[model samples]
Target: MRRVSEANGLRIWVDGDLRDEATRVDAVARFQTLLGILRAWRSEAGELRDEQRAGLGEGPVCDEAGNQFLSIGPVRTYTTFGGEIEWFAECTRRGVGMSQHLRNALWLNGRLNRTAADFYMIHEYAGVEFGGSLGIRDKLKLSTNSQGRLTRAANNLSPLEGGRHAKQSGEAGMTLDEQRTYVADLLRRWINLHSAA
Candidate 1:
């Protein structure tokens, strides 16, 4: 079989040697089966995307120890979102660069929130080096393509982003919170598998 084209965000493949009517019919049947599977997957992924997006807008979530974090707040100079320059100045005054400050903040957030410290540290460092959350995502998305699946299904999937930048670089692209979520998800799945066993 060979991939022919991308049909409606899904890869369409054509089977080899369609000289006979039986072979043609079988190929059509297989294509239809694949279409059904794709449709089902699309539906499920759509639902999951909705849920994930909704979760993103949620209020400050508390950790297992009832410690709240992950929200922007007022600072002496400005609000959390507006205090970028002020924060930079403060960090500089404290003999810490912006990158180091971000690492410290992310690490503190991770520890207080009972999250993955290493993932947050890496993600924040990458974000500082790049630009913003989108930059982090662009850099970390490469992890998904490590195996290099040349299919629309893999391309259109979550975390893939299907952008040209994802191809330009091979960095571990992920946002700080996304990295923590990814780490937690891995541990969760591992526990589930182990618990069932």
Candidate 2:
């Protein structure tokens, strides 16, 4: 697939919920709960994976017929979405920088008292690196590409006075969208083909 170089003003997006969706639909408390669940699952899932891989001893997780439906399929579908979104929530945010990412969410009174976080974190180093330099624009873009790709929403709202997305370099190109479709399709195919067994 074609990738835009850093030279291209960077229209990159994760296509994850590629989300950041109806901030009005979620609550910060829920995001906190979601984070906890993911943490537990990650530990459990890793154990199962390690057990499966240990047997393979540097081989593929397949036999001559095809793949293991009992093992890989369900685990992956659940684990991936589970882990990645957690990674976003946990890893990619921080500090005074953190509050600013979801600045508009304060104005929103979600029915459920929850809102998708404004920024998705991939790293949580200093406040400025991910939250400041990369900022809201880039977080949504990266979030949209990662776990956000799986979600189905279009709440990239950045139009009010303070509602502005933090300024980061949003990419310029079609790669993010194209790759999202292709990979989503591939994952669907892989699951259908294997799970049927």
TM-score of each: 0.21, 0.18
lDDT of 2 at 169: 29
Q: Each candidate's lDDT (Cα)?
A: 0.37, 0.30
Say which candidate scores most in lDDT: 1
> Which digits, one per residue and each the tens of the lDDT, describe model 1 over residues 41-112?
221121222234334434466889999776543222212366443343233223322234332432232232
Question: Candidate 2: RMSD over Cα atoms?
Answer: 20.2
Error of 2 at 192 (Å): 30
Give per-residue CA lDDT, model 2, range 1-197, as digits (tens). 12245663212223334246644234443444333223222322212333345432432456678964333322343424554643432332222134432322212211121112221121121124335424422532334343333122112322221112443223322232332233323222222222333
Candidate 1 global TM-score: 0.21
Give lDDT for model 1: 0.37
Candidate 2 residue spans exceeding 4 A from truth: 1-77, 81-83, 101-197
